[model samples]
Target: MAQTSASPDVATRALPATWTTNLHLSSDTGLLQEGLDALEGYRKKDPNKVVVRFRAIGNAPIMRQNFYKITVSNRFQAVIQFLRKELGWKAGEPLYTYINMAFSPAPDDTVSNLFKSFATDGHLIVNYSTTAAWG
Candidate 1:
């Protein structure tokens, strides 16, 4: 289909001088400051490798080498898979892993973020159990 284009004269027309001059302005500077603070809070500088300490919960078997170092860019699922391999757990078996015995991070959560938020004494404590051990 043939399309008609705007005339050169019409295309070059400028907007009214007052159109941009009278634009609404916000008087609340506090909101802008809060937004800046929030942005600063969200940014976290991560290291190349994160130290992960695996701890047994309840009747779960303990890993001989509790401390394992992994790249910061890895996701939480990689940690879970490594634990399962060490414990010889099948794919369908129930494995509950938590950070600092507090909460379970999502599979897609980055190791760097988890380490940044929950690492203690330069190690990220990961608790594991065959069943639910904590709320």
Candidate 2:
């Protein structure tokens, strides 16, 4: 089962610092598919456990983007490189994110709604804009 945060807000322990970059995966479905594929592949190779999610923020470019931050690990640099090179989630012009989850649940935490948050712990919150326009 997943672990919960100290706060009643229902969160998991933070992950080790992972990656930091950007992507063009818009807020749409088709493009999100590519982003998902890229990310999932990275997760498989990543030593530290991590997860990614997409929240529909209407149809604005700013809204369609995601915020990815190095939630918990120390190897932040390596992960960032992976995101830029291995994965095609490139950084964009004046990227910005508004993430706040110092307390996320474990991967199996009930408080996290079965990881519906796509954030088991502190995550690589990338405020990305995929070509799909809603990824």
Best by TM-score: 1
The residue ranges of model 1 lying beyond 4 angstroms of the native Cα positions read 1-47
Which window of ten consecutive residues has the lowest lDDT sum in model 1? Answer: 1-10
After superposition, which runs of candidate 2 have C-alpha atoms over 4 Å from their true positions? 1-46, 56-92, 100-135
Every model's TM-score: 0.65, 0.22
* Model 2 lDDT tens row, 25-124: 3456876699899889756432344443323223424423344433233243433343444334456622222223222223233212322354436543
Give the per-residue lDDT of model 1 (tens digit) for 10-116. Answer: 56775576855534575668867987999997665555897899999999998889999998888999999999999999989999999998899999999998988
lDDT (CA) for every model shown? 0.87, 0.37
Error of 1 at 30 (Å): 32
